[model samples]
Target chain A: MNFVHTMETFVEGKKKILLILLAVFLIALPYMLNSQYLVTVAVKIGSYTLLALGLNVLTGYTGLVSLGHAGFVAIGAYTSSLCAVKLGMNFFASMILGMVVAGLAGVLLGLPTMRVTGTYLSIITLGFGEIIKMIAMNWSSVTNGTLGVKNIPRPSIFGYDLTIANNGLYYLMLVLVLITTLFCIAVVKSKTGRAFQAIRADELASTMMGINITSYKILSFVISACICALGGALYASLIGYIDPNTFNFDVSTLILSIVILGGMGTIRGMFVGAAILIAFPEVSRFLMEYRFVLYGVILVLMMRFRPQGIMGWKSTMPYRLSKNVKEQVEKMDKNAPLNLLNETKG
Target chain B: MAEKEVLLKVDNITKRFGGIVAVDHVSCTVRKGEVVSIIGPNGAGKTTVFNMLTGVYEVDEGEIIFNGNPIHNKDPKEIVAAGISRTFQNIRLFSDLRVIENVLIGAHIKTKYNFFQSVFRTKKFREEEDKKTAEAIQLLKSIGLDYRRDDYASNLPYGEQRKLEITRAIATGAQLILLDEPAAGMNPQESAELMEFINKLKDQGYTILMIEHDMSVVMNVSDRIYVIDHGKPIAEGLPEEIANNPKVIEAYLGGVQNDAEDQ
Candidate 1:
């Protein structure tokens, strides 16, 4: 057991160094790009990473497919924006409130998971996203309907405004992404994370093992919603405006696809998936025009070739190999029996 | 002979799926510290009985009293909380997790950390997690799986996977453990080792009720055996009694003949 601990941490230590380097690169990305347009793209990747990180916890780790994450993001954006505009609240505090509101909605959405799963779950979530969009469209007094919310205030620390003009918002987004990534890794290492994986592996076995699937399922949804809500709040503040159209079914699908492309149930995969998904279209005007077709093709190819995504394959961890390899190889030979019979006949 | 207190009582439970009655008015009891076996042919309602005991299926008609509480129709999690744990007949393990993680999940009911504590990794959380990890490792060592603790559960060979499932059940700290089929796919040597492990569990004062098709394991490990056919118990007695009972023999042979005719 002690040796196991040492070996496990040795592997974990390598991951830690890699994570630190990644964080450093993200923080310095704005300086490296030296262009506001690319910096904005990096910021978009950061927000997408946050969204994919949360969805990974729900869809990847818990194995509950949700197609309404953008609904939660909409709830977050509206809630935070309204809180700041109508009530004159702090930007950061309003974002927290947004997370809470969206989290409650997640609980309401997760209740159906007690009875429905898989494709049915996906359908329910799709309905939830549409319902949210409808509310955003009709609730004119609060949301201003399709006209949308504008001039959303950016967050500030010690009176320093974090806006795109100052390149501070990009840094803020990067830091949030870093925090979210760490939070996800922490969760995947905890007991609750283990229970979620257990449920994903075998729900009946997980229940028999004393895991309350209902509560864990709800908890996963709540955490996932909160993270998405935070991303939504940041998006509103970053763009200085948001409308119901931005938070649509396509956005949810995009977030989910990011989780899938990055690798389900892995933290690093979020970054890889988000970068490619966010950057690919921006780099190619033709891809941007045929984005839907490209998405369909990528998904079809992924399903056919690598359903586990880029980083989902199991790594070669250190384990003791069987010592009788030569003997096993001999036994595996199809002609070994024939040779033995021939010798006996001779 | 002194009579042992009943640890579990399942009385007249029936389960129906649409128009078919899977289990009908089945009744059985497992006494404390006893190794009891429920043997039946395929589709004899053995697994259904186990499912009802563990609260996997809501009983259509019956009462399951465990430690003096009527636990019939309780939520599976609540049933587990009341100190009952089970393994599936098909060896359902958390394949995505490491072997130790499967066992740690079994200790979920025993852990003290909540969501907040887990997220924060506070002092109390760390202490409790360390304690549970130590306990889980100890359980793996006892079950002879410590060597493969870090390997994914799915990576294990079939026999070891069965052993891991049982080990996970044991990790739950249940007073009464129900095994659906502990020796279904094992070779003779593995089955014999499993019989030894079951005996060791009995010596440790754990009450065990099992649903098994392996007659060798059923006859050797069970202090008492109950034979069920067509959703009802046909006979119940000592292993010797069950082995020689005319009704039990007829039911088994009749079941085989029915299977052949259906084929």
Candidate 2:
């Protein structure tokens, strides 16, 4: 425990430097690899990371497991794709539109399922994912029937088209991932985040704390859906083609697996999880179909042993005290009764 | 002293669960700056009364007036906004969060910032967050749990967890605090300390409504005691009067001679 504590402090102290180095590495990754396939894989990881991070808010922080997150992704991809194709809309504008639509869908889903919890909620989400796919498959005029929205114009900024070969898409993914991470960090650190964790810890206790569990739960769903839709918008553009099959139950399972494998409720875990899970099958093609079997075994073993996931270990460092709070503590120490002062010193 | 202003008036509230009436027409009034206790034997609907008051359960009938407004049947969040907060009998601290975070969550209702402000880290968000954090830390200090503020709430010992729960309730800016069995599983020494701690709160002018099984703490700390049995109010009076009330004794010890005669 002592050794672990020291190690954690060491990591905490050098955190900023480490983060800078990581940022530098991610920026130079495509150049260093010089492989389009590798860049594509990196982009995939980025997309999955965004999805997992979004799902983390609901499942990890708020304790609401959603299996139909892919539905939000589908909504984003289709809405953005359809807008770009039929209306000749700009990529960013359409993407925002897609996100808004998905958020509305989240509100719709959250309201009806507010009274349900645990496995029941998961089932509803699972059905939602299927329903979305069914709509995409059957809704011919808008979705173009399973042939899918093809020839999706690549996203561009300042007249430069983003493609996997040019690494524009990769950088765009990186920026979105960073923004989502920052958003997640901000949400987790604030009063809203505390309420989310409180609800997850104990619904009864959270309600007693005057937290409007209904509104907060709905808010969580909205945030999660928006993030997932962002990822979906990115995916549709990256692949330059999107079909109903692209966002199936399997994709939802993969995103959830990334969350569970990376460590739920930790932002850093999503990056690691997405990197390993997305890159694993590519590198381990030698294992053939057996790679999937290995994947199941690994997840099961993780559950049996480190159920908290790789990065889910609770930090040993003291909870961060804000600058103002630190000053207050100092003032309090000075003004404390003599006996209390003596007790604190001792 | 002049008659104390009533902070809470629970008038003839009834709650029924199917065929069972959990709390039957229970009525009580809590005055400002007083430590009022509801004492009852096990399964006497003490917790049900607490749940109804806190809006965890809607009253089947009657009303709960708080600060001269009928607050019964309102959402728990609105009820808390009206200045009532409570701790659980089972000590429902947010185990995963740090101690200070748990207390900060109690101050959630008091935070004025919106979701956008929190997301954007706006000036208002920062100011309110820093203020609440400092206040929470100060509260922890008062309870001597400041050093453990960074620790996960579940890591605290049982007594400290109970103290933390009360501190969390107090942080909610509540004018009236409800404690559901605050001394359920404490040793004599711990109960004594709790009695002192409750007295300290009363001295701070916070009205307290508690359901306590520990007679010593209840008798010593409460300005008045209300006794119940089988979901029915048996007696209400000063602690000394309650200790002498034949009906209170009968409710607690179960009418010994009457049972003997029946046998």
| TM-score per candidate, chains pooled | 0.89, 0.96
User: Top model by DockQ, which number?
Assistant: 2
Per-residue CA lDDT of model 1 for B167-263, tens digit only, reads 7887777888888898988899989989998887787677899989899999999989988888878999999988777778777785554454442
Q: Please compute the TM-score of chain B alone for each predicted structure, in the order given.
A: 0.94, 0.95
Candidate 2 regions exceeding 4 Å error are A1-4, A333-346, B257-263
**Tens-digit lDDT string for candidate 1 (A1-346):** 4664675568676988877897787777778888988888888888888999989999999999999999999998899988887887888899999999999999999999889988999899999999999999999988999999888888888778888768899988977887887788778778889888988898988888788899999999999999999999988887778899989999999999999988998887888999998988887667666886786788889878988887676543543222342233233432221112112211
Model 1's TM-score against the true structure: 0.89
Give me the runs in candidate 1 sitting further than 4 Å from their true place.
Answer: A1-20, A286-296, A315-346, B16-21, B255-263
lDDT of 1 at A153: 80
Tens-digit per-residue lDDT, A1-346, candidate 2:
6776988888899999988999999999999999999999999999999999989999999999999999999999999999999999889999999999999999988985568988999999999999999999999988998999999998988888999989999999999998999999999999899999998999999998899899999999999999999999999998889999999999999999899888888888999889888998999899999998988898899889988888777777888877887887888752333122112211
